[model samples]
Target: MTEKIAIQTKNISKRYVIGTKNSKPNTLAGEIINFISTPIRNFKKLRSLSNNTTDNTKTIWALQDIDLTINEKEIVGIIGSNGSGKSTLLKILSKITIPTTGEALINGKVGSLLEVGTGFHDELTGRENIFLNGTILGMNKKEVEENLDKIISFSGVSNFIDTPVKRYSNGMRVRLAFAVAAYLEPEILIIDEVLAVGDSSFQKQCLGKMDDVAKSGRTVLFVSHNMESIMTLCTRVIWIDEGKIIKDGDPVSVVNEYLETTNTISETNINLENINKRGGDGSIKFTNLTIMDKNQKEKTQFNIGDTLNLSISLKAIEKGLLNSNLTIKILIKNQNNTTVLSFNNESYNHFIKLDDKNNKIQFSIPKLPLGQGLYSISLEVWVNGGKADTVGDVGVFESTPGDFIGNGIPDQEHSLFHTNSVWS
Candidate 1:
C-alpha cells in the first residue's frame, strides 16, 4: 500500500536583508555634510539589490536546505522559538511568499489561516468573504452554499455574519476565519499561531474541528507553542531551530527534546524576570525562585527521602490585582519530560491571598518519593480563572535514591517513583 503525498519541499530556503544603520555625526557641520550625501548613498544601496556584490553579513537565511514530504491525512505540527522561521515556512507554503532558492510542490488546494483576517477582505461582509474564500479555493457557488450554514454556525458569529469583517473584533475575526478554513474543505489546511487570540473555549472547539478534519483524510499543518495541543492533535511533529529542521518524529519524543534543549535555567537560585520562554498575559510575574531544605538553606541536590521546599516570589503588574485571589501551581517533570508530580492550590480549594501582607508562596514536600534522577520545575499563576503567568524549566534539581522504602539497599533503576506497599 502506498500513501499519497500532499506537500513536498525540495531544498526550500528563504533569505532576507538586514538593515544597517549609519553612525550619527557629532559635529553640526559633519551632520550637514552627511545629510547632503544621503541621497547618493540611498541610490547606491537601492542599486545594489540587482547586483551580485551583496554583503553576506547584511543578509540572513531564514530557511536552509529544508526537505520535507507531508502525506495526506497527516497532521504535522511545527514548533520552535521566536525568530526560528516557523512562520516563514508556513508563509512559503501558503503562496504568501516565495522561497529564495527552492520549490514547494503542493498537490491540492491550501486554505491558510496564517494570521488574523488572512485571505479575507476587510470591506466585505463575513458572509460575502466566505464565498470569496471558497471561490479562491476553486469551489463553485453551489459548493460554498452547501457548507455555508455549517461555517456560520460553527464560527459563532451568525449575529455578525452580515457585518463588515473590519468591524469585527480580533477574536470574532479569528473564529470566523478558522471556521471558513475548516468547513470550506480545502485538501490542505495550514494554521499558524493565530488561535491564541480567541478564548479558551473557542480554542478547544477549534482543536476538535481540526481533529475531525484529520479523520476525514485531509492534511493539516498546525504551528503552535502549546506543547499539549501538539502532542494530542498532531500525528507527527517537526521541530525547527534557527531555520533548520532539528528533529522530526513522534510527537512526544520531538517535543521532549525541544523543551529540554530550550530550557536553559539549571541553578537552584533562579531569576525569572529575564527568561523569554514563558507564557500568559503577564498580569502577574514570577520574580524569584529558590529550592531549599528544611533548614531554609538553598540547594539543588537532594536525597530521595529528603525534605524539599520551594520558595517563590511574585509581583502583580497592576495595583488593582493586589486584592485578587491567585492560584499557584508547580509541576515536577523528569528528564524525559514526563510530569511525575504536580501541586496546585486550587485542587484543594486553597488559594493565595494577593495582598501587601503576603506575596510569597512556599511549597514543601516532606518525603520526596522519586527515585534517583534529574527533574525540572515549572511554575504557573492564575487569577480570575485565567493564566496570569506560566514558566517552564524555572529550575532543576538532582535526586539520589536514599532508603526511600526503608530498606538498607536502594534500587536506583527499579522505577521512576518510589512507593510503599505490602505483599499479601
Candidate 2:
C-alpha cells in the first residue's frame, strides 16, 4: 500500500495589515471620500516619508504561495529568520488563524505550542488547564485522566499542579504548557520556538519527548532557530525568506544555502566611526577587526571540519597596565538567532601576552563541530577582566556538508547534546 500524505497546502498565503488602525471607516461613504482625496494624501505621504516609512501603514505578506507536502511519520523542520513566517505557518496549521487564500488539508489531529503560555488560561489552575486544553484537542475526560499523572510528573511541576497558572514563574509556565501539548498524543505535532524559554535540563527533556513522538510514527512539524536541533531531529528541512520558500531539501544543504546568501563579508576599508564599547573597566579598545579564510583572503566559505582564524588588532588606551588580560570570544549562530557554540574570553585567557605595540589577537577553532549549514560569529574584546569592545552585526560563514557515506548522520559524530543515549 502507498504511504499517505499527512499534511498538504496549495498556494497558502497570509497577509498582515500593519500601521493602519481599526478605527479606519469601512463604509461605502468612507471609501469614496478616501478615494477622492487619494492624490492629496499621496503628496503628503511623499513629503513625510522617512527611513521609518516601512514601519508605517503598510501590508506585509507573512507567507506567500507556499506549497508543501509531508508524508506520514516524517519529521520536517521549518527554518527562517525573525518575521520570516515560520511561526505564522505553524499557527495556520494549528487552526489558530485562517489563511488569506488557498487550501490546507490535514490528515490527523494536530497539537501545537506556538508561543509561551498559548492555549492556556492564567486564571485556571495547572490541573484544570490540562483537561481544558486536552478537551479542546478532542480528548475526552477519561483519556485525559489516564495521562494526567504522567503529564504532571513529566513537567516536574507536581508541587504546583493545583496552583493557578498566572502565579507560576516563566519557567514553570513553559514546562506545564509543553507537558500538556506533548502528552496530547496527536497524530501531528506543531512546535514553535517555545523550547528556548526553559533551562538546559528542561530543554533536554523536551527534545527526548519529541524524539519519542517521532519514533511512534507520528508526523512532526518543528520550527526553531537552532541549526543543531534542526540537523539532529529533522528528516528534511525548508528554508524561507521574506515570506517565500527559498530552498527545500536535506537539512544540511538548505541550511548552508540560507547562511551563504545572508552573510557576505568584503575587504572594504575598516570604519570605526560608530564603534560601541561594551560595559566594563576600559583598559583596551579594538582598533581593527577582520575575518579571513585560510588563504588569507576575506571570504566566508568554510566546511564542517574547516579551520577558521580570526585576526583582531587592538591597542592599550590606558598607561597604568596592571595584570590586564586580553580575551577573544566566538559565537556560532544560525539564521534564527539561536546560538550553537559560544567561546568566551575566559576560555582563551591563558594565551594572553603583554604588548606595547599594536597587538594581534588570534584565535582559531581547529574543527567546527557544527554540521553543514550557515553560521555567524560574534566577537568580543576584554581588558582588565571586563568587556572593552564588541562587534557583531555582520560576521557569518558557510559550512558545506562533508562526505559521510554512512547513514543520514552528518560529519558531526555527536548528536544534539540534549539527548540521553543509553543502551537498554
Candidate 3:
C-alpha cells in the first residue's frame, strides 16, 4: 500500500536577526494600518533572507535544510535541547511564524497548541473561544456546537466555560485549548511542550487523546522533554541539534541514543554543589556524588551482577537541620527516563542521625540487576516531613553483560533489568 503524506518540508530554514526593532503604532488607525501591512513586511523580509548575506553575526538560523515528510497516521516525536528549533518548526507548520527560506507544505487542516493561551481571545469566554478556534479551522458553528460539551467536560473546565479566557489560570487555559484542538477533528495535530503547564493527570489525558487521534487516521507532531511519553505515544522519533536533523528512526533506538548522548554524565564522580537544584527548599543541599565498584574504585561502567556503590555528601544550610528527621532517597531510571529502581531510608524504617561535620551517606546494590544500558540516578532529601533538597540525573552508570545465570545468555532484549528464573 502507498503512503499518503500529511506534511512535507523542503529545505525549510528560519533565520532571526538579533536586536531588530519594530515600532509600535500610537493611534487606533495606525494600529489598523500596521496590522494590515504586517504580512507584506514579513513577506519582504522573508524574501530578503535569501539575497542578503552582508552581516552573518546579526542573524541566527533556527532551522537549516529541514527536509521531512510525515505520512498520515504517523505520530512523530521531536526531541532536542532548548534552542534546537523544535518549537520553530512547529510554529512554521502552525503558520504562527514564517520561515526565512524555503517552505513547509502541509495537507488538510492543522490544530496546534504551541503555547498557553494561543489562538484564544482574552475577552472571549472559553465557550466562545472554542467556536472561534473551530471557525479558524474552517468548522461551522453547528459542528463546533456538537462537540462543545465534550470539549468542556474533557477539559474539566465546565465550571469556568462561561468565564473569559483572561480570567483563567495557565492550567485552565491549557486544558481548554487542548480540548478545542483535539476535539475539533483536524487532519493534523501539532502539540508543543505547552502540555507541561498542565498537571500530570491532565498530561496523561492529553496523551491518551493524541493516541485516539492517531488511531483515527490522523497525523500527530509532538515536541516534549518527557522521554517516556514520547516513547509510549510516538511510533517514530526525530532528534534535532544545532538546527539540523541528527537522528530519526525507531522510537526506542532514537530515544535511547538521545538520552545517552545528551543526559549521561561521563564522569564517575560529579560535584553536586554546582549542579542546579530541581526542587525543594534550600534548607539542605547535596554536595557531591561518586559512583564506584565493589573495590571502591571509582567507575562509570559495571558488569551485570557486579556490586554498585554510591556515596552522596550533603550539608545543612539552616540551623538545627542536622538534628531534624531527615530522609534520603536515591532513584534510578533507564535510558527511556522511566524509573527502574528506587531506594529510600524511610521505606526500610532505617533512621539515620546526621553529624555536623560528617554528613555523607552510602548506598550499595549487592547485585546490579540491570542489563547492558545506561542508567541515571536522582537524589532527594526530606527534613521533618518537608522536602529539603532534590535533584535529578545527578549521575549515570552503564551496566554491561555479565554472568547472572549459570548459562550466561544476554537478557536485556525484552526487559530493562535482568532476573534469575528457574524452569521446572
Candidate 4:
C-alpha cells in the first residue's frame, strides 16, 4: 500500500500590503470625512489595480513559491527567525488566510491552535468555548457532548470550566485552547507557539498529547521557537528563512543549520542604533553589541575551553536614567532553547551605575562550559522598574567538540557539559 499525501503546496505565495504611514483617520470627524471621500479613493485604487503597478513600498511577500508535500502520519516542525514568515505559513495551511497566488491542497480536516484562546469567546465560559471550538472543527452536538469531559480533563481546567475566559491567565487560556483542538480528532493537526505561554509541566503534557496524535496515524505540523520541543516531538524539520525554505531534513541538523546562519555576528563590530530587533521601552537603547575571544579576535566559533567576551555599548535617552534601578541580564540557551546559564550583577555582587549618557559593559567567561553544540545568546535590560529591552535568539555561536578532560574520546552528544572526573 502506498502512503497518502496529507498536504501539498504548489507555487503558493501570500502578499500583504502595508501602508508606509497611517492612512486611516485618527478622529471621529476625520473618519466621517474620509468615509465621504471613499468614492474618490476607490476610483484611484481601481485604476491602479487594473494595471500591474502598485505602491511598491506597501507590498511584501510573506511566502514565495513554497512547494512541499507532507505525507499522512508525518510530523513536521517549522523553524525560522522573527518575521521569516513561519506564522504566515501556518495561517495559510489552516485556511485562516488565502494565498495571493498558486494553490495548496489539504487532504483532511484541520484543527489549529495558532494563538492563546483561539476561536474562543471572551465572555463565554470555558465549557462553552470548548463546545464552540468542537462545533467549529465540524463536530456535531452529540460528538462534542461525548468528548466534553475528556477535553476538560486533559486541559486540567476542570475547576475553572464554568468561569469566563476573560478572567483566565495566558497559561490557562492556551491549555484549554490546545485541549479543544487535539480532542476534536482532526485528521490534520496544526499548532504554532501554543506552548510558549504554558508552564514547563503543561508544555510537557501538550507535547506528549501531540506525539500521541501523530502516532495515531494523523498528520501534524508544529511551529515554535522552543527548539527543544521541536526536536523532541518532530520526525522532520524545515528551516524557513526570508519567506523561503532554505533547508529541510532531520531535526538536529536543520536546527543547527538555522542557528549557525541566522543573526550571526561575523564582523568585529555590529551596529544597533535604530534597530528594532527587540522589544522594550524607549528610555534607553543599545548602540552596539560585540562578541570576541580573550585575544580580541572576532569570531562566532569557539573551542569548549576558550574564553569568550561579550561587550555591550548603550546610551541613556533621558538624563539621570542610569542612577536608578537599572540592571542588565545575559542568558545562554542550549540547542533546545532551554536556559542553561544566566548572569546578572545582583548574582555576582557586582554593581554598575549609569553616570553618563554613553556606557560600556563587559561580561567575560573564563572558559566556555557548554557541550559540543550551538548555543544562542539572549540579552535584556531593565531600568526604572520596566524592561528597556528583551531579545531572544539574537546571537548564536558554536562550541567545537573537544576532549576538555584527559579522556581518549569526547563526551557523548547528549552530555550538557564536559567536566573532570575523579574515579578511584
Candidate 5:
C-alpha cells in the first residue's frame, strides 16, 4: 500500500521582474532619457545582476524552492507576511499561474475563490457567473445545475441573481463567489482572504461550509490573517516567510510562531494588506496605527502614570458619513491575551464626531492603570449599525514602572490589572 497525497510540490519557484530607478535620474530630461533607454538599461542591468553576484537581483522569487506534501482530507492553513508568497503558492496549485522553475502536482479537482470577482465576468449575470465559475472549476452544465439552487440560496443573492454582476458590490460578489466555490463540491478547496469582503454573518457561514467540506474528506488550503480562525479550523499549518516554507506542522505552534514574528511595536505606517485577520464593510480602512506618549514621542514602553495615546489613521471609502454614524472601540489586553480594559465610543452618543474627512483618530488614556507587562491592543470600528473595520493584535506596548504616587515603584502582576486598594 502507498500513502496518498492531496497536493505536492517539487522545488517549486516563481519569479517576477520589477524596475528600480537609476540614482542619476532626478530631472525630467533624465526621466525621459531613462524611459527611452528602458529596454537597453534592463538588459544591461540583467547582465550586471548575472555577473557572479550571487544576489539574484534581476528577479524576485515570490516562491523559492518550496517542497511539501499535503495528505488527503487534511485541512492545511497557510500563514505568512505580506508578499511572503502565500498567494503565489495557491495560484500555482490552482493552475491560475505556472511556476517559473518547479512543478506542482494536484491530485484532485480544485475549486478556488481567490479574489472577490474571480472567475466572474462583469457582463454576466449573477446566475450565469455562478455556472461560469463552476465550469472553470471543471464542473459541467448538469453538475452546476444540480447545485444551482443551493448556491443561490447560500449566497442570498436571489433578488439579484438575474442582474449583471457588474453592478454588484464587493460584498455581493464575495457572497456569490464563495457560494460557487463551496457548494459545487470540488475535491480540493483553495480560499484566500476574499471572505473578508462580506459581512460577519456570511463569513461565519463560509467558515461553516468549509468545515463541512473538510469533514467530507475533501482537502482544504486556508489562508487567513485571523489567528483565532486558523487555530479553530486547521488541522495542520505551514508558515511561509520570504518565499520559503519555514515551519510546517501543528496549527497552534505554527500560528504562535507567525504572531511572534510580526512587529509588536511599529513606528511607521502599517501595511493593511499584510493583515489577513482584518475585515470590514468597505466603508473605512485603517492605514496606520501608532502608539505614543503625551509628549508626541514614539515608543512602545509606557509608564503606568503616562498618558498613552493611540493614533489610528484611516481613509474614508465614500462620502456622506456623518461623525455620529460611526463608532470606534479600542481595547487592551495583558501578555496572556486577556481583555483587561475596553473603551467604546458609542457611535450615537460619543461627543467627538468623525470628521467624515478626518483621516486620523486618537484614543487617549489619561494616567494609564496597568501593571508591568506586555500588552496588546485591538481595534474595531462600526458605521451605520454595521462593522466597518476590525484589526486584532494591532499593536503591543510595554507597561513599565510608574510613580503616580510619591514612590517610584511599578504595579506588577501577571493577571488582569494592578490596582491600589486601601483597607476599609
Candidate 6:
C-alpha cells in the first residue's frame, strides 16, 4: 500500500521587495537638480558606479527552492536560526502566506499556532474564542461545546473562561491559544515557536498533548530551537539555512550538524557572543564562554558518563559591592518546550569574585545521563543578591547515544534524563 503524504511542497519560494535610500531626495527642487544630473549619473554607472541599485531597491528571498514531503503520522521538526525561513515554511504550509512561486499541498485540515494570541479576539472572552477558533478549524458549534471543558482544563484557564482575552496575561493567552489549536482535532498540526512562552508545567502539558496527537496518527510540523524537543518528538528533521534546506535526515544528526555549523565557539572558545543569552537585566554580560572535555580540548561531542565542563567569562559594568554568583542552568527541552532536564545554580552553584577583571566560572557535570541529542546551556549572574543578568539558549552542544549503565533511573538521576522515560 502506498502511504499518503500529509504535506508536500515543490520549488516553493518567497520574495520581498526592499526600498533603498535615494540621496537625490524627494523635494521638487532636489528632483530638478537630480534630473539635470541624470546624464552624469548614467555616465558614472557606465564607469562602474557603486551599484546604487541596491541603495534604491533590493529583493530578499525568505524561502527558495524548498521541496519537502511529510508522511502521514510523521512528526517533523524544522530547526534553524532566527530568520532562517523555518517560520516562513510553516506559514506557507499552514496557508497563512501564499508562496510567491510553486505550490504547497496539504492532505488534511491544519491547525496552526503560528504566533502568540493569533486567531484570537481580544475583546472576546476565552469561551467565545474557543468556539471561534474551532469554527476556523472547520468544527461546528456543537463540536466546540462538547470539547469546551477539556480545552479549558488543558489550558489551565478555567477561571478565566468568561473573562475577555484582553484581560488575560501573556502566559494565559498562550495557554488558551495552544489549547484551542491542539484540541481542534485537525489531521495535521503546524506549530511555530509559540510554545516557549508558557510556564514550565503548561509546556509539559502541551508536549503531552502533542505526543497524544501524533500517536493518534496525525501529522505534525514543528519549528523550535529546542534541540531536545526536536530529537524527542520528531521522527525526521529538516535544517534550513539562508532560505534553503541544508540537511534533512534523522533528528539527532540534523540537529548536531545545525549546531556545529551555527556555533563557531569550540570546546575551548569561551566567548559571550558565541553563546546563547537566556535572561537577565543586561547589566553584567557574558563576554566569553567555552565547554570542554577532560582533555580540555574544544569538545563538541559527549557520550553517556562523560564529564562535561562549561567555562564562562563575564564582565561587570559600573561595579559596586556586587554579590557575584555564577549559575549554569542546563535545559533539555523537546520541540514542544517539554523540559526533561533543568538544572539551575541552586542545584549546583559555584561562587565567584568579580572586581573589574574578567571572571571565569566553570560547572562540571561528571556524568551526563541524557541520551543522544542536543542540549542548550543557560548562564545567569547575580549582582548584590538580586537577578542581574541571564543568558538562555546561548549555545547548543551535542550528546551522542550511550548506554543506560547507571544504576539510578533516568529522570531521578541527572545522568539519565531521557525525554520519553516513564516513571512507575
Superposition TM-score, candidate 1 onto the true structure: 0.62
Q: In every candidate, how many clashes are there? A: 0, 0, 0, 0, 3, 25
Residue-by-residue lDDT tens digits, candidate 3, 141-240: 9988998889889989999999998999988888887787777677888888865658889988987887787788878899988888888889899999
Query: Number of the top candidate by lDDT?
Result: 1
The TM-score leader among the candidates is: 4
**CA error at residue 298 for candidate 6, angstroms:** 17
TM-scores of the models, in the given order?
0.62, 0.58, 0.57, 0.66, 0.64, 0.59
Kindly report which residue pairs in candidate 4 clash with one another: none
Query: How big is the positional error of residue 218 in model 2, measured in Å on the Cα after superposition?
Result: 0.8
Task: Assess candidate 3 and give its TM-score to the true structure.
Answer: 0.57
- Write model 5 residue lDDT over 33-87, tens digit each, in one string: 9799989977877876434333454357789999999988899999876568999
Q: For residues 54-104, could you state the per-residue lDDT of candidate 6 as single tens digits?
A: 332245678999999888988999988666788889888878778878998
lDDT computed for candidate 6: 0.72
TM-score of model number 5: 0.64
lDDT, residue 120, model 6: 87
Superposed model 2: Cα runs more than 4 Å off? 20-57, 264-336, 339-424
Worst 10 residues of 2 by lDDT: 412-421
lDDT values of the candidates?
0.83, 0.72, 0.82, 0.79, 0.77, 0.72
- The deviation in Å at residue 361 for candidate 5 is 17
Q: After superposition, how far is residue 287 of candidate 1 from its true place, in Å?
A: 20
Task: For model 5, state the Cα shift of residue 120 in Å.
Answer: 2.4
Per-residue lDDT for 314-384 in model 1, tens only?
88766657568888889998754557899999887886776655777888998888877778899999888
